[model samples]
Target: MELSKIIPVSKPVCRSSYPDNPHSLCRRFDPPLLVCFSCKGQHLENRRYYYYCATCDLEFHRGCHLFPPEIKHPFHLLHPLTLIFLDPDFQSSRIPIDWPDSSSESDDYDSYEENPGSYEGHIVKCNYCRKYLQPEEFGMAYYHCSTCNFSLHRICAYIRPPLAIENLKCHDHTLTLFPRRVPLPCDACGFSLDTPFFDHVYSCLLCNYMVHRTCIYLPRVIKITRHPHCLSYTSSIVPSCELACGVCRKTVDVNYGSYSCTKGCRYALHSKCATNKKVWDGKDLEGVPEEEEEILEPFLWIDEETIQHFSHDHHHLKLRQDGGSHENKFCEACTLPMTVSDRFYSCIKCEFVLHETCASLPRRKHHPVHKHPLTLFHPSSSNPHKVERKYYRDGFFTCDGCTRNCCGFIYRCSEQDCEFQLDVRCASLPDPSIHDCHPPDHPLFFNFTSGSVMTHHLHFFIQPHHFQLLLHHLHLLPHHLHLL
Candidate 1:
């Protein structure tokens, strides 16, 4: 038989029941511990109160013991949260919505609540702080709302103020917190809520505009990975303009929002495109002055007609502007036939012929075909980038830069083992270029190349009938423009 109850150390604990320990005793701590059992809060060292202690290791405060079985919180107002100390039901029900076992409650849950105080290798994200909660926080006390499956740190719940967010840049209305996971698209960034199942967002019921709570804090100006300049945020990307993103090459809606260079540069990007983890470095430089870049001239004058070529060794090549039509004349660099009125470089005596631009090709070049720089490779040399493979005896080297299988001069990567080969057309593209007859006041910049035509506003169009060109049934690839 059990002996009589022990003497009252302090006052009697309130009438409350716990899941793990039901009939608990009232006890006063000799030396107040640093933490309480229910709230995991610091117990004042001197002040004494009624506390229920199942074991000497864990104790709860009188107020903590009297926590309403279920209470409503200001952060999430849709559902009342039950005081769940530790529930095996934390593993959300995963049955399909269409199946008989399925329900509205979320089953895909975090593993931290499964085995209390034993989540070793896990990524537990906190919805309130927008940070990954450490393993110790899950081991300690916390609150969980089963309907939304949203959990908060025990300490965070106390200090977190009522939900109230607003930003003039994103929206004018006062935003209310929406804690439930819904299939809704955000209006500020114009993207669907791309977070996990349990995350929350801010909504403006008046305008029907919803935005991720995190996106409200995005910087007005930022430097992305692909560009060196800081791009300023634009609230209205007019839909009729048809702007393309510099990173993903996707079309940006004119009526949506985006970022663009402030110095009248043509570099434009979508909000999501610029803030991507792969593209953005997470720096806000709004209103910071960034220098405008100018495209530099590619070459200096060598002479009037005759010039020394970088690809050839012995004699100077003569520039022929009026070399009329021929039976089978072709440029050695581009491997394309030369038409009448085409300007090109011709050897004095030998069968060497190159387009005038190709003669001035740089010995080394940087092209988008490879991340590393490429050097012009000549025949009869060992290249480090290529594995020992047999080549056609017909003097033909495959050019990956042009995606062509032909014989001609090419640029190749030698050190990085980067398997990139380029013909002169893809290799010698200049940073700044000028026209022979109608050059623009500012040099044209080399941005990127694609099958799509550039959206730049053309200053003027030149007449195509100025030259008496030769015609042939040459069925080659069409639309290889130096895409601005």
Candidate 2:
């Protein structure tokens, strides 16, 4: 019979035991030569239909197993969603955008459930092509509305955008689609509602302007990592100087919306701080194509002060003045805790170290608490699940600067409404502090890095006005620091 000579006598649809083979059973490779978690594409190169779980090495994709473990959608008909695949970043769900489109169901939808794939930070997006659903598209997934715990992006729950948005671009009229989802603030970019969904913006019943589909075109001229010039976009400015914000140095509200620097220079930047997701990379580079400049990797010394570290291969890192590791150590590059009086930069023979100011960091800087520039995320952890979220290794999230609750290497808040955090134990403080504390070895200067928990509380010694004297409030603690 011509059923491909009897479909090769089908069999192997499910057998399992995988987390790398806990003792064999394998099978199920079905016909997916590699690339299917559900339409991330890959029909044949070896033919694979997927389903392998293998305890958790996971695979699945018979169209993500014919979907529908429970979905309902009308943009969130108030719960009935539960399909889940993992990687909503911290995936406790929450995505459908502001939710509450109601249709009934609330009580947390009887505890949802489906998760289990093993989390790992992929960043999800795609409330309908806001892009980033990638991680090989999580094997055709992205749902979870489950009564408003929120979720959706296995292709925006199966495609649906387009109610109105024509002509748009500095507009001559025609721009509808703000009908719901509020949080305003983007008459071109005063930044409110950084969008993942909330309809991403595009209004104007007739006047006020409202752009942002990533700020409708806007870029009379750009270029920003924190400026070298090129900014341009000036619709208005009164600045006699000090416009602030070369990158979150704050104080840039000249009425609203700005970019400044077509040579009038003095440098500015905030239309949401020049669209920062770590300072613009969402692109609209306008013309694009000449790029290719960032080379810089030099300072890697071993002479004037030791170097050599492609992440410690064999040995040769040098610089551990008091490096660390009598045991409780840690900072192999932001793992946190390494206080032996801190100064770091080791590798004399084994324990491998660094924190001699994290061996020079500043592949980018900024940080007056967050408007953009802390960007180094992933300074280490080649694996072991990186920082491991959903509350791994404890700590989870907290520490806009010692408000407490610690994990490691966050430094986030590239705007987009995301709050702000620090946690690398206050990103490795020691600013002007040089051991021995008050008096004696003198240097103590830490300035309370933007504390929280009350009116204010960061004072890391703060009294070296060149040493005018005041030394009392020092509340420091990554491992130790007295004098409060």
Candidate 3:
């Protein structure tokens, strides 16, 4: 047994059983009607013994009473784990510890710190289970390593396997546990094994296959919403030039493991990127058959030049290709002024109009910035946000990708509770594409920036006279707006 993984707070508090409560004092009860204060379970029994507090009228499972106050876990050898309490919403309890600023000395461990709260209003997840820990309702206790900012579920700390294993699904040969920590890359995920919380390493003697314990059971076949074809895990890809990961737009090292399209296609993705929680839905499609998807048209045709758009079903729109001057007219979808030579659709009854390209945009699209499908939301005229009359007459929505205020039809994330939205311009940007104004050899990429400034690279390509106009249009200052 690994003694470092389990360290008790103090010697187990031995107390006498309450003779007044016969059922509570017993080791087992049918159906377990009594509630345990620690686990909050209707059943009052577990592998650990039960203890009762006659003074407080509280009963607890023995495991809760003996929970270790500190322990050295193999996953995080840098620091010892401390027992911490969190509410249902994952908010740290009123209890205080050395945090954000750890150098300050405190007279008492349980006393509130003089400094403001260190960690609160932050989402904490168990590193092993990847699930939110809620100790408030269930009376569960979790382990935390503040120095390393690592967390582990209380039960996960007890999950210890034998030194060796055999009969694996992903590999054919028997695998042995490597005892010592090695600074090498895992052959399964192509990520360095020296990473934190990945100390458990397994290896095969028949071949040079070595992998971190966490990556030993990678799915053989998986499907993601971003790709059309199913992807299969491969030990390595054939050496290639200029190969980039489909999701991150970064170069893929061909010598390590990765996921590649089973169908004859050039598409590939890094194992780490493909299995990201934001990208993969955590479904293994090894034996599952692919389902056919039905294509839906964005609009219905009324005549040769007229159609009814889903967004504006109140009236039919007539297409116009002739160069006509509609001085103040703007496309409702893109919020850009209608050019004299542009082909667009105009409402037969009202002033609603859309650029030809914007009118044909799909109702749902896959964008490189987001993993989930985004649904198109028509502009709300009642909204107060708006651009200048030159760009749009009224109404605007903030683009989540570029953080720009835009007056146009926006695509919002389809996932519930996710408020991510972006304008048509930011949504249509290609990941790796060439710009006519910039050098052709250096392809431009869509980089999301949090700072309110554009990068210096723009000054080299943009004309002097138009630079001010570009800043003015984006509502950015001289030092603001970083774009790629």
Candidate 4:
């Protein structure tokens, strides 16, 4: 008999117990035809072999049976990892491990006090991918070490990255995988020495170039919405004066890695802040040619004082330095009541109106809070029925930045599936902003570390000029306002 025929005739004992049957024997199927009970799909379009149960009509991939009872993963070798199935239902009877009853209040308090770091009580995530293990119907099987409470997905267990990496972009010498977490500063990004590990750390003993796994692949050159020119990743920035981040308006430590302007400008951003998913577009523009800048005009000039605005194109708006005085009339862009001392644009034929600042807003611009370029969008101007169902469900959308619901013109992200929207007020504030209320020389900058507006010598809100200005400052400024 052929070996293929003989192998199919053999039956294997399945570790998984079937309902009412303590011992379930599985038979090999030469050509898999049914969906796998664990994975919920065929292995390879009926090409691979699998184990099937005739009584329950359930199927399992051949690899599922081949899983060893325990494994000694190279990354975590202090203790052996055991194979276990994590149930998704949250009420499964097959608990991975049983804990002694912590009903005694003193025992719980004593255990927590001894090791507070281990009792974070966060949801279990895969040690490899750092993703929450949301198991599917039949429960997701993975390798677990109960002693350390470390777990890895089934796929990550079998597929391991090389132990040693050479010719890495961030480092010069051959970097060996450090296997476990170490309290050492990463040379690429200034983290993990004082702070917790961002991911796995790779180390070069020869050059002392220790770096995080994720930081090894940091883009050499990239463009962010915060700056005008492209920025290149730099190991350090030696400035005569203290350097503040252009994005968060926080101080940039010169000793650490950061992204600096390529045009020799006095602008720099923290490595972590520059690569924030909401800040960078995630494209590596190392050798790519820069495209010609697109025109960002909000309207075409019909005349010097009159123009056809993009949002309210149905009528020509006439610019007015002073809008006289109106009680009921409101600026259509900001949804604020028109004031006598406001510079605004009024529609030539209709009640449509806009603030001068609002009308001059470009068709597309980048807000500091979002990664993608935001387009000037009018909820009422789009498809009336479509907008009604999508945005006007409650007659207003909650602004992602400020969390205030407003019925006004919004700067919405252009990317599909991204619903990030910013109200006119929050979108207009410039980073490292200078306000006319203070002085021209003193620019107000926000300090992310101290969580305060660093005015240096100027006093902000010492005496309020108006209630509206005070309200705006109170709403945006953080709790601890440092005068310095």
Candidate 5:
């Protein structure tokens, strides 16, 4: 057998050196022919045999039959796994070994073989339960299992991708996916993403801010403190002279982001302090709880049973209609004036009365706008009363639960180390509610309360009613209600 007769002599030669000529009588050898293992059909002639199954007569080309060495799965985003072909002798009989529906002989094979570059194939695995996927289930990534509902795309199963979160501007970094398992902070919103993340992780280099990749893009404007106005972001620092946030009574400073009025009328908040969702617990105040119900002796027209209040502490507290007073009476809780009210909480001792709406505020709260819980605070905890120089001060404190500023009546933690606070209105809101004025069975609760009156109607009316009903349903006394 002449080797030159069968082999093409003018083919582009490879760099490797080979024998120029072979003996003419070399046992009449012929190149091995490659065939498909399942059908035993001739796939390629004259190629090195790769995949050979003795029990089921088959063969494959070396290049055509190779598997990937390492693969990164979306389901397991933390680490990349190596692909290993299962051996026949392995004990796991449940594992699928064969390709699906390869019996359809058609002319498409010729086209695919001719244009190998255009041919595409993929491998998949389950996200929840680690199961190797069949080729037929390639496109059904989005549709999850009916029983277990574990479904994902090959890319999603292998490499966890990043999702866009809103509003929450994490510390200095933009949140992104974590490559390897390392204790890193989120880039977009400063949070720890070390816990169980969905599929993606956000990280930062400068600070210890890490969070879920889905938590990066939080909403910009949010409701907080149950105020009529919507709290808008202010890039500038809060005024130092402002003392505490209007919602949570925490110290407003330059370090954290602040929310304030565009008109700059002494209204300001720490970004996290303003969005508290609960009422303050009275552990932070220094004085003992007042027992006696105080009613104005001058306005004492009603009987003793009808009047319920702390009479010894207050001098001139009185009941007034909502938006009834022209003169701005400073609130004992927030040290502000009563603008609108269906009811009012007044101090008979010092002519101080908050709007009825303001009096029924909460002590602590949790907000959607913030990641953590917040407490409320009153004004006079540290600072003296601006109105009465001789009177003792009592006010709310802000909780450091979230990143909003304290704006309205606040709920604060008793712990000196933890200055957590939430706005009174924020704290008093329920998770869900049904209203008489609005549609029946309508799920309502205190959401965030922005300062803007035009857009935030829920804070003005819905929040007040919601708090009142909650107090009534909880079986709290009117005096105890003031503690909210």
Candidate 6:
């Protein structure tokens, strides 16, 4: 018979037997096919079979079969292969396999009549890193190397499967592979993991925290009262303070973590402050009503040509056109040197004048810790019990927000119901502020008489003059509310 049509048979090959059932043969339309030792066979698909080697075309469905055994592989000239009966010792038996040189045509089986000795002892290679390893390194159906820490199962090495499942535990939404780097922070800890880390992420819409796919299962509701709304990870940038952070008390750049507002106030909280438990008492106080409406007045009257600022004790303060001359002038607020340009207050009579920085001090402010708002006082009233009074004797007011003494200017409130106050510098602060400038949408509003008093801290009261100045700078003309 011709070798191609012979249908090579094994010596007493094993097979699974089924009870005389007519439907068994009919059900085997697509029979389980197997190849073993240069021979192939077709068996019933439902049978319990084993030992079908795809490399040699030999089939063995039952356990009782034994066939002629070959001790050596015809293709391998140097190394002899062996059959494994049980768990083989990989540490001692592992060996590397070499590929035939690309230039050697003699290794091609079709061209050469004899065995090419090229397919005898081949080892599997890792698909990801492309490193080859010995068969002994793979003990079971699949295995991995402990030394290099490279790993893959037999099916895993050949298959390119998706890395993530549809519903993972870390997040509420399905996680997809993040093949590219994201510009925002992580949804979990708010850390910037845009570097080399490979994983999935879930983003929240309420705060700056970006959670990784694994961190999505973490609790969503954190009990932080510093913010009026519950904090969540969001993509929005928040309004920040001009000075250091109010909570961590650390100076941070604006690009870091930000808190979100639920009231649509366009306000953002610092990450630390967002998680704080202190609640803010929501109270909006209107300015005190005047018995007879006083005509609104400008804080200072100036001529078109030049304006001079004079102190009661000073002879005269002449205005200078050069801003560089006032570069080193002192600010009335913190008593720091004024480095800003454009204007200054001078008394020509006593040759004494306040810089533009001193003249810009705020008259009122509200603090988180204070119950009532504080006001700015011209030659601020004496508070003998308070340490700030010592500095107040020199016509300076202490900032109720920070409790620090200031000389540039001061603010105060007259109503005994509201105690809130601020130094000139603190009171002039703008809402929804960024550095020195305030956003236009949320213009500053001033309250002089019944200055708004926060309910949480009744002792703190809003100052009117500072609020009025801030409004004036915004170019908002006062109607009923008069400047103090």
Comparing candidate 3 with candidate 6, which one achieves the higher lDDT?
3
lDDT of each: 0.52, 0.49, 0.60, 0.63, 0.38, 0.37
Per-residue lDDT of candidate 2, residues 3-69 (tens digit): 1222232222322333253422133545443543433333332223234545545453333433435
What lDDT tens digits, residue by residue, belong to model 6 across residues 349-450? 543445554443334334433333444444422354442443355554455554655554455544354444565444544432211144433322222223
Which scores higher on TM-score, 1 or 4? 4
**lDDT at residue 63 of model 4 (Cα atoms):** 40
In candidate 1, which residue pairs clash? Answer: 92-107, 93-107, 237-254, 238-254, 239-254, 239-255
Deviating ranges (above 4 Å) for candidate 1: 1-55, 58-177, 194-200, 203-209, 217-231, 238-255, 260-269, 274-285, 288-292, 306-354, 359-484
Question: What are the per-residue Cα lDDT tens digits for candidate 1 across 200-220?
Answer: 578888877777776777779
RMSD score of candidate 2 (Å): 23.1
Q: Number of clashes in model 6? A: 67
Number of clashing residue pairs in every model? 6, 20, 8, 0, 120, 67
Which lDDT tens digits does candidate 5 get at residues 216-328?
Answer: 43334544333433445544454457554555344566544555553345666654354333322212111333233232231333342222232213344456656456246
Instruction: Write model 3 residue lDDT over 164-270, tens digit each, in one string.
Output: 76746767887777644567788877787666663577888679878877677777788775677889888789886657777666788888778888885898889
The TM-scores of all predictions, comma-separated, are: 0.41, 0.24, 0.60, 0.64, 0.28, 0.27
| lDDT, model 1, position 72 | 63
Ranking by lDDT: 4, 3, 1, 2, 5, 6
**lDDT of prediction 5:** 0.38
Reference-based TM-score, model 1: 0.41
For model 1, what is the alpha-carbon lDDT of residue 199? 43
Model 5: residues >4 Å from true position, as ranges?
A: 1-69, 72-80, 84-157, 160-178, 184-190, 202-212, 233-484
Best by TM-score: 4
Off-target runs (Cα >4 Å) in candidate 2 are: 1-137, 140-153, 157-175, 178-199, 212-242, 250-255, 258-484
- Two-way TM-score contest, 5 vs 6, winner: 5
Per-prediction RMSD in angstroms? 15.6, 23.1, 12.3, 12.8, 22.5, 25.4
